[model samples]
Target chain A: MNEIPVGSSATIVGYTIHNAFTERLREFGLIEGTIIKLLRKAPWNGPIEVQYGHSQIVLRPDELTNIQVKRMM
Target chain B: MSDELPQNPSLIALVGSPNCGKSTIFNALTGLRQKIANFPGVTVEPKTGTVKLSGETSVTLIDLPGIYSATPKTPDEELTISVLKGTHANITQPNAAIFVVEGTNIEKSLFLYAQYAKLAVPTIVVVTMIDAIKGSGGVLDDIELERQLGVPVIGVVGHRGIGLDEIREYLECGDFQPPLLADNQVFTGKSTIEDQHLWAREVAREVARLPEMDSFTRRFDAVLLHPVVGPLVFLLVMLIFFQSIFTWATPLMDGIEAGFTGLRGYVEGIVPAGIVQSFLSKGMIAGVGAVVVFLPQIIILTLFISLLEDFGYLSRAAFLVDRIMGVFGLQGRSFVPLLGSFACAIPGIMSARIIPSEKDRLTTILIAPLMTCSARLPVYILLITAFVPNSLVWGFLSLQGFVLMGLYIIAALSGLVIGKIFKSTLFKGSKLPFLMELPPYRFPAAQNVFLTAFNRTKAFLTSAGTTILFLSIILWAMAEFPRFEAPQNASTADIERLQLEHSALGMIGTTIQPVFAPLGFDWKVTIGVLSSFAARETFVSVMGQMYSVDVSENNESLRVVLQRSITLPAALSIIAFYVYALQCMSTIAIIKRETGSWKYPAFAFAYTLLLAYGAALATYHVGLLLTS
Candidate 1:
């Protein structure tokens, strides 16, 4: 789903990162098939913190929108 | 311990992800035997230290910059990749690598560890934060982990000196096994991200008994990372930090001032009233002493910063403020440099080297001087004491303190505005993703914090001894030359004033008078403003000489004399001007050296001068209107 609910855990389908900067997302191990736990989304649609394995990061909301995910049953 | 090993020293690299205790480990390993220098063609200063293992067997440890992987992105990341690939000309391939992996965050740390093993260098996994992990009720089987990874593992608390002896013995032995994964199948296009994480998870599961969560740390992070409470706490903390620099530093600053004045008086009394006496007392003592008085404040501020940095709060601060700063077309990387500017712009501009993007680095450098550096402290204190009232503003906040804080706020806002303008017009580049790892907090090492302060103090003193001493001598000559005769009825103060007016400096000041006349600056203030371009702190000493040179027998301070000499409007105008002015020639020189071009510095100077004049003009006219 495009509007992935905050505080929900999901599995990554893949990413649609279009810029040179988004390649960093892959380098940071935000690749497809990893389970991402969205912890919190900041106010005013700011940075969103997500955790995968032992790594946790705060990324911009607009940037995270491109990462297509499947909500776990 | 190492007779069988080669007599020649081996080069070892200490590579780790950011905030992985790399520097702490390096400090613990090398003690005082470290040298800092920029990597060839890059501004990232690689720290090399001598790690003596035995009587004569030592290894040179090159501390590489922290990076996640080998793919080159930033200039710093590019440097690390080049050095590791054995492509950088000045650096030879390392004999071994002490790959530091944080014990608590093995999932991510081991990924980089696995990447490092592919280079075919013999590696030892130094698991740091072992104590912290054990405190949280987690356990690591170092030997089993070593067996699993096919590399030797030594768990070390780098700051506490735990496991250091074992580490020393291992390096001295110079016998390490190869990587277990010789095929390196995980990262060699044979495996996907799923396979790599699975490998890391498998290794971690075998050797580590990690708790589901460290409850104490998790609870603390709940409040600290809270959306509503986090930013408020940050603002309140920063407010107190900035205010304490002025409030807490006052008594110490006074002690230094009193001590220097006493020294100058004693030297003046012993020597005859001639050129040598004047040069010693006024030129050398007064000029350099004025800047030296601010050293206490610089130390105090840097101590606070280093403490926050060591405590891992600064990176969280970067996280909290990134969105706000990004509005100005800057990134989280600019935060550290801007914070450094609060101490001094020279180091602040130099610290901009950490920003990966050339455009972002240049933008940060150009606006660094607007951050109300400590050199501006003396001027601010002088003006605020002379003009701003000593009464309380809102119960606890003193008006002087409030005004001081106000100036800093204005500087920060001005920097943001200027950064936005530069980004939109002059140099536009794509924004890099903000991805910073927030390291777990640890108690800061007192030695490391003090060493950082000591280094800053040394750099400040070196500048004061050389450039400041030279400029003060020239200014003293300018104010003391061409012996103009005074009228018989002229008072001592008037005679000194007339001498200053007709001397070489006075002629230059008068020539520049018309240019500054619209801002209500007299020839004397013009002289102070002109000399300050070499160094901002020189303005205070220049004014001290101009106003207090054999003028008064009363116990009146320079600030008192200045209060009588200038109007409130003029003082306010000058303060406004200094807030925006690029009054430091050293900053300009460093920018020129860093940018490798005259155009950027020239542009920076012209734009800042224009902004300063415009701001001062607006303040002057506004003040006139309000009073009238």
Candidate 2:
């Protein structure tokens, strides 16, 4: 799998959700087919802030390591 | 529905939208021992106070955050929505609700009341602030209100401690289950909204018999809430608040610094000249002292803010700012969190729960750190007082103060504008409608103020302390290693500082100086700015580290070392860096957790850092040309 650099737009293919966090995400409507834009990769690589569904939000970067997105120009 | 359910005490929730005086009622029911904190990842932890009934039964009085309905669009409102349904891990069953409503605004509250009625929890309506009603020539018919809603209605005047028992009695009694809507009321398509308009009108007709409009409050709101005047009023309110933070906190700050200094001196006297004294003074005194002095500024800001919020001016301010907020696709409720940002972004981001739309809420959270919270104040004051001349701008504005004010506004506006731009360009969606219930104005509750002050102060001492101390030690090491000669005592403190400067840690600051030079910062300022990454307030203490400055409760001050040492542009640039820099590590942690992805947090960091870099660069060069 080629690693897509951050800042590239991607369509969320699927996510490996931490049960509690996933349940919490399901509550806020985060699921498949969501188009997301990766905005920044924090120095610690702890998390990423992305523009999703009309709001720019921050989430753990590993949460995205599984939720695959195909590169968009 | 389980027969094996443990006989834990029944719960009584003090429920209402923000500013409905639910907290006041909570304090009245559960006094000093109230436990206040944020719930899980969200900062909007509804305060819960345990109370023992006269019958030897115990009840946990959970004061949920203010929300407009049983179902909420934003996380904060979801606080009410979640607990009411017992879906939250913390709450297990439906019990009873003490629904608080502002007397002045009855119609808007009915919408909430009607929603709660469906939850089947025995509910009581407590109408707060009756004394002001008479002055406004409005009379509430308690009997008619009870008759109309088919529930017991009790009116309490919270400020003077009047009608508090009636509220207690109604809560204890808890035998009413009113129909969700009146016969004529039509249910809206959203099951959550049981005829919002009808319930609003029901509340208006039955509960709000007469509005006690205080002429003074009205006049004040007239100007403050005036579309044109409101923003000005908000600015003036902030200006006054900033003024008090600087002026009022000085004596207390001095006292705290002196106390720390005394502690350091006493420890030095006992230990003699070595690592003990160095560690005690530099790590303990210098590190902790820097934070303690800031305690006063934090308290004052929270105190005045709680008062203004209690008095109900905050809601009107929200209403006033809603139009402007709309321009950027933000909601008026975002104002409170933004306002909280001025004190500290941690709380500011936490408070963003009050905003209902997820998009708006996240945007508000992202931008809240931009508010020039008091944590940044020490750094701002340190720099401007050191560097910038205390001159009047345009023959009226305090140039220094206005610059401070401009930095704050810039942070807030940039947050909104960026959020808007993100919404328009990067994240595509129309702005959500700004819907809120304006709580009727009342006297700010005194007990609530103390509780709030205590909570924030405790957070500062504990949560804030642990984070800063850990970061300080790391940064100190960044300046401490690669041991160099201890310069002979001009003073012991001087020797310790020379040790710090020549140490490995100090070299790190020098290394970072070139990167920050565009912002008019020297290596020392660069180091403080970097150390401040742990928390913005640490900038002041890092400066203390640089200067070997010490202080205590009796004889101490930040102005002493800062006065002659710093130039104006350096101070301005420092303030500018803080103004734009997303230096709070905690905020990034929170954002990561809240959004459930690392992607957005990373985005927040990159963009904020970029913004800070560009702005600080501009401020440095522009300031140099102007000053020279």
Candidate 3:
């Protein structure tokens, strides 16, 4: 998806993680089936907070676009 | 042997996903005695604090930036990995790790915990936010998660200061008694542990519970987060913030002026009418006074900011702006470091720890000085008030305030554009993926608010005492050295200006004058710009010293000086110069410290200087053309 609406829930699909995002995701177990909730967005909606399982994590939007997500209930 | 505790406090490195209340738990465990340093090789920040466990065992708590892996994405992310592996250049490996996890999202929080479990350090998991999900009828089987994950798990409400002592006791003993992996079997191999993924699933299914979304939160989100209205609300809130900085700070600013005047008068009277008085009143008092007058701006700015963060609106604010930032190739997580840059760029660079991508965080740090800090407010006020007329556009809005706000806006836009260009040219990388946790909005604690305000104000004053003090003395020497013996008041303005042309500073300024003349600047303004390399706000004090004028009167004090030879447009040029300038040497130093390498900071300094010179030159010569 070119644009993910703020607060819209989506399933983790695939991602193009930079070395930093990839390394952090590896530690957090952000691999297959990691359900993400698009939490709060800002004025321009560039950086976002996501709900990965019970714990929520913050990431730049660059990391999100790569991880393909399927819109979920 | 049973009661043995190490002579030194056990060091526990707290690592987890961001916003898992790891900071809250760190504060609860260590309170205010925390030492913060920018991480080596990157602007990422790590905080070190200590908590006493038992008589013999206290914990040296290092709150690492939230990272998901032992392997890092950006230089910022590598801080935890290298340090944890005992392979970092500056630090030994941490003795243990306190892996923080969000209770509501235990399965995900445990993902990182599982990674840490294999690290071979003594690891303990503190399940935070238990109270946040308490009313949801959701409770964690902490013991079970601990069993399944092969780490000791302690559930606590860190925000409320609950479960702190049990945490201490757990840290006192570094042994892990994990849950039975298939009937009390001792774990033998990596394959066996990976095979137990199903075991973790079964435990989560049995013990963890979550409730439906709370109505108040949902309703609040409906309006605050409404796509149509969200951006508008965000703009208005920012407007109120910028306005309060000028309007609300007036009384406090006036009080500061009065205090400085009183101190100058007292020091002048007591020190007698010799070099000491001149030194105290002119050099020290004047220099420090110029810095402290901006205290009102610092206090008001940080007060509103702390409240915004406490209310949990800062993240939401970031969320709203993420889409537009993407167009510039700037990541969404840049908001924190850029926001922090308003106080000082060092901390701004350091706060980049929160950004998961090294490229984005370094990019943010590189452009941070473009943010208009309170330190630069004095120079802006000095320029705008001295030249821009005091008039109202409509019935109410003061023209001066409008110009001030415009200057801030210009600085912010410059940072973003420069960030985009920097990424494309020097730091070539695709924008890294980014995400953040949105905590349920809560009324910020009064203590947190007060502390934040206190810290900001205190730092501003210290900046005056340290870097400002040193720069002021040098500027004073430049102005007063090779003293001019004058006959009368009618000795001519041209002579004084010429006499300044001979002084150490003026000579230096004149040499640089030709270089800046195309930009419409004379030698004096050039000197002010050079002196300000130490501290941006020192531009005003340097001008005051150079002109030998009273600066305590604010607008009236500088107007007569500027009105003498400088044009309305020339003064505007200086303002433009200050707007784009990366004059703070300390900011550069901070960049060096945060990046841990000369390469990124050098790149940051070079590009920013280029942008400043180009923009300033454009504003200067173009304005001269229009006015001519």
Off by over 4 Å in 2: A1-73, B1-9, B55-57, B101-108, B130-153, B160-163, B166-238, B319-431, B481-498, B501-504, B507-579, B582-606, B614-628
lDDT tens digits by residue: candidate 3, B5-117: 53233677888866667877887787766666544443455777779666755668888877644445555457788878788887667877777876766655544554455
For candidate 1, write residues B358-472 as lDDT tens digits.
Answer: 7888899999988988779878888898899899977888999999999999999999899999998987765565666566666899877876676556655564335556656
DockQ of 3: 0.43
State which candidate has the highest TM-score: 1
How far is each candidate from the true structure, as Cα RMSD in Å? Answer: 4.6, 13.4, 5.1
- Quote the positional error of residue B430 for candidate 2 in Å: 7.0
Q: For model 2, how does the per-residue alpha-carbon lDDT over B24-77 read when each residue is reduced to its tens digit?
A: 777777887677644555545567777766687657888887775565645667
- Candidate closer to the true structure by lDDT (higher is better), 1 or 3: 1
Chain B TM-score of model 2, please? 0.72
Displacement of residue B183 (Cα, Å) in model 2 is: 12
For DockQ, the strongest prediction is 1
| lDDT (C-alpha, whole model) for all candidates | 0.76, 0.64, 0.67
What ranking emerges by DockQ with the best candidate at the front? Answer: 1, 3, 2
Q: How much does candidate 3 score in TM-score?
A: 0.80
DockQ of 1: 0.50
